[model samples]
Target: MVPDTGKTLCADTIRPVNLPEPVAVREDAAGRPLMVALGRRLPVAAIEDCWRVDDEWWRARALSRMYYDVILGSGRRVTVFKDLIDGKWYHQSY
Candidate 1:
């Protein structure tokens, strides 16, 4: 016994979440993030952690990226990654 609702659920109604977005980043000689642009330039205070992921080699579009968890000068923490394949930077959050 449920009340009638005028909404229908289908594939069209589904949406993805937490998708990564492109970002501008400046790196040091060692390829460490020195600054990131999130509307404005934010200097990286420290790198909390770093890792690399290289997977799906069998697939046509393989994934290879270097991820960095950094703390900004303003005390905000963020996660950014550099696509090793395409050489582009993106920001993402868990």
Candidate 2:
């Protein structure tokens, strides 16, 4: 389950969370992702959160949104979600 810091920490007995297939980040005029934007630009705001849920695990890709939070950057604060199926990442909002 997701801890207080929003990190997924499955204990010994629990199965791993499923995630989505990885995706690439294209610069389409929008600001870069936090990972890429970290060194190059100083985020106007910066925050972190975590999640850990197990749903639809029987399906090829079955997971649920445990929780999310707003992280502000130099450009804007976005809500990020972790797809438990394939370990992919997504933005909740602009």
Candidate 3:
């Protein structure tokens, strides 16, 4: 036996968490991030890692990005990425 609460589960009711947000990044001549604007500008201390992702190329809207894991001057680590298709920057957490 089961009780009906008049509720349903569907994709429409689902939402993404920790989706990347647009960010302001200042890059050097070599196209490396020097500073990033969170609330204010924060200098990048070091680039710990870098990688690229190019997926779903057969789709109408493909995904392509260059990701960087860096340490800020305040010793906080953050992940940022450049959208290769749109030339935009974003900050994300993994």
Candidate 4:
């Protein structure tokens, strides 16, 4: 769970909210996100958690997602992931 920040999210629950517009991201040496473009470029304040999932390998389009739970410079928390299969980034919450 995330700390309370006055957002609508319940302190003990996470929900998926797909990005209306996917943003471009700049990664650090270890391939962790350092900045994200959401309306404007916002630096990542910290990464709270991370994990990976690889599925549907036998399908024509497989799923290889690496998700990162991060806090922005403005103190807003978001979950973003890289689609390893397509090499793109998207913001989501779980």
**Of 1 and 4, the candidate ranking higher by lDDT:** 1
lDDT of each: 0.96, 0.46, 0.94, 0.86
Candidate 2: clashing residue pairs, number: 13
Q: Report lDDT (Cα) of residue 14, candidate 1.
A: 94
Superior candidate under TM-score, 1 versus 4: 1
lDDT score at residue 37, model 1, on the 0-100 scale: 95
By summed lDDT, which 10 consecutive residues of candidate 3 come out lowest? 1-10
Point out the higher-scoring one by lDDT: 2 or 4. 4
Candidate 4 per-residue lDDT over residues 1-94, each given as its tens digit: 9678887757679754654346699999988999988888899999999999999999998889999999999898988898887778988744
| Backbone atom clashes (below 3 Å) for every candidate | 0, 13, 0, 0
Residue runs of model 1 more than 4 Å from their true location after superposition: 1-6
**After TM-score superposition, what is the CA distance of residue 67 in candidate 3 from its true location, in Å?**
0.3
Candidates in order: C-alpha RMSD to true structure: 2.7, 13.7, 4.1, 8.9
Candidate 3 CA-lDDT value:
0.94
Tens-place lDDT per residue, model 1, 1-94, is 9987978889998989889999999999999999999889999999999999999999999999999999999899999999999999999967
Write the candidate numbers in order of decreasing lDDT.
Answer: 1, 3, 4, 2
Off by more than 4 A, model 4? 1-21
Name the better of 1 and 2 by TM-score: 1
Q: Which of the two, 3 or 4, has more lDDT?
A: 3
Clashing pairs in 4: none
